[model samples]
Target: MRESAAAWGLQLARALGALWTSPNTLVGLLAGVAGMAAGARPHWNRRDCALVFHRWPWGPGGAITLGMVILHTGDTLDVSCTTYEHRAGRCEHPRVRLGDHERAHVFQYMVLGPLFLPVYLLCGGVSVRNPFERAADRYAMHGRGWWPGRS
Candidate 1:
C-alpha cells in the first residue's frame, strides 16, 4: 500500500511538473479562458488538445474556432464545415488542414513561449514572409497544390 501511494504521488508530481514546464499548455489555457469569455464552448478534443467554437459577436452569425492557441476567425468559420476551402477542391478535409496549420503555430508557441507575440509582430504580422506563418503554411500545405481561394 505504501509503495503504491509513493508511486501515485510521483505520477502526480510528474504531471504537475510537465504542466508547469509546458509553454504550450499555458498558452492553451489562456486561449481556453478567452474562448469561454467570448461565449465559445468546447466543440471537440484531440488527444491533449481541444477545439472551441463560437459565434463572432460583431458579425452576422459568423463562426470562429480555436485550435491549439491559434484563432481561426472569419465569417465562414463553422462547425459544420471546414474553416477554409481550397480553390481546387483538392483538400477534402478542411478541419484537418486548419488543424495542421494551427498545430504548427502551437509548436512555435512552445519554442518561443511569451516572446511569440512580439516576435510575430516583428516578423511582419501574418504575411507569407513571416517565418512563423511561413512554417505553418508549409506544414498545412504539404503535398497540397497552392489554392489561393479560401472561403
Candidate 2:
C-alpha cells in the first residue's frame, strides 16, 4: 500500500510539473510546428520523455530544449565532461550524443519552468560559466541526472 501510494504521489507530482511547465512547452511546440512547416520531423522519445524535432531551421546548429520539446539541428554533437572533471579531476571527454545533452535541458525546464530562459540567459547563455549548460554537459558525459544538487 505504501509503495502504491508513493507511486501515485509521484505520478501526481509529474502531472503537476507538466502543467507548471506547459507555458514554456507551448513556445517549444510552436517552434517545432514552424520547423515542421519547413520540412522538419518530430519524434517522441519515450525514454527521455521529450518531443524531439529534428532538422530545426533556427538556432546556432545544435539542439535546444524548451520544456518537453527539443529542437535539434541535423548534426552530430559530442559533449565533453567539464563539471565532473572540474570537481573530481578527470580529463577524459566522452562521446555522448546530442539527445542526452538536450534531455538534460528538458529536466531543467521541468524544474525551472518559465524561469528557465531568464535564469539561463543570466547565467551567461551557452558558455561554460553557465551552470545549466555545464549540468547538461555533465549529464551527457556521465549519463547521470541533470540536476547537480550542490557544488
Candidate 3:
C-alpha cells in the first residue's frame, strides 16, 4: 500500500513539473509578476538574487520557493551552505557577524520587520528570483562569457 501511494505521488509530481514548464503557463504569468513586485522584492542584481536564495543562518521566517529550487546550480554550493535559511522574504547581503549589532539592526528593520513584510507578502508565497538566470541575463552581452557553456 505504501509503495503504491509513493508511486502515485511521484506521478503527480511529474505531472505538476510538466505543467509548470509548459509555455501555456505564461498565459497567467502576470499574476506572478505582480505578486513579486508586491513583495517589494524587485530584482536588484546577481548578488541580490543570491542573497535571497542562498543566504543562511536565517532568522525566523523563510521558506524555499519555486524560483530558488529551479535556479540553483552546483557551483552555488558554498554560498548555499553559508546561508542559514534562504527564504527571509527580503534580500540582504549575508555576513558572518552582526558587526557591533549595527548590521543586525539593519537586517531587522530593512528585512525582517515592517519595511520588508509588505513586499514579501506581495510576492504572494515567499518566492524569490532565480539567481543563475538573473546573472546570465545581466552579463549576457559580455561577448566571451563569464563561464563556459553557461547560456
Candidate 4:
C-alpha cells in the first residue's frame, strides 16, 4: 500500500511537470481552470450558504472565487448568517439554524475557484456557466434540502 501511494505521488509530480512544460498554452490553461473549478465547487457552495445569500455573487464567476477564498481564510465581510445561538430565556428566537446546504455551497466554491482563480482574475472576469452551480442545484433539490412541501 505504501509503495502504491508513493507511485501515485510520483505520477502526479510527473504530470504536473509535463503540464508546466507543455507547448499548448491554451489547452494547458483551460485544463488548469477546469481542475480548479472541479476542486472548489463543494467548498464554494458551503461558504456561500454559510455566509452570503442563497444565490451566486454578482459580477461574474470571479466574485464567487473571491468569496470562497475570503470565507476559507476566515474573513467574513458581508456574510449574513454563519453562526447559531441558543440563549436560555432570551426574548429572541431560541435557536438559530444555519442552512447546511448553503454552507456546503461555499465549500464547493472554494474548491473549484482557487484551482485557477488567479488566471481568471488576471485575465479579467469571464461570463460562463459554472458547473458548481448545476451541482448545487441538483444537491439542493435531491439531497438535504429536499423535503415535503419544499420546492
Could you tell me every candidate's TM-score relative to the true structure? Answer: 0.49, 0.81, 0.23, 0.26
Point out the higher-scoring one by TM-score: 3 or 4: 4
Per-model clash counts, in order, read 0, 0, 9, 37
Considering summed lDDT, which 10 consecutive residues are worst modelled in model 4? 81-90
Measured by TM-score, the strongest candidate is 2
Q: For residues 1-151, what per-residue lDDT tens digits would candidate 1 score against the true structure?
A: 9999999987686455444436655555566566567764444434323343433233334322222433444322223323233333544544435555555555455445556668778987745556665565555656232222221
Question: Each candidate's root-mean-square deviation in Å?
Answer: 9.2, 3.7, 17.3, 14.2
Q: Which tens-of-lDDT digit does each residue in 1-151 have in candidate 2?
A: 9999999998887677777788999999999999998877888886667888888888777777888988888733343324434444445565566677787887788878899899899988877668787787778767885775532
Model 2 regions lying over 4 Å from their true place: 75-91, 149-151
Q: Candidate 3 residues 59-117, lDDT tens each?
A: 34322222212111222322322122233435443432211111222222222233333
Q: lDDT tens string, model 4, 11-81? A: 68645533443333234234334444434222323323322322222222212323222222122323322
Which is the winner by lDDT between candidate 2 and candidate 3? 2
TM-score of 3: 0.23
Candidate 2 lDDT for residue 37: 85
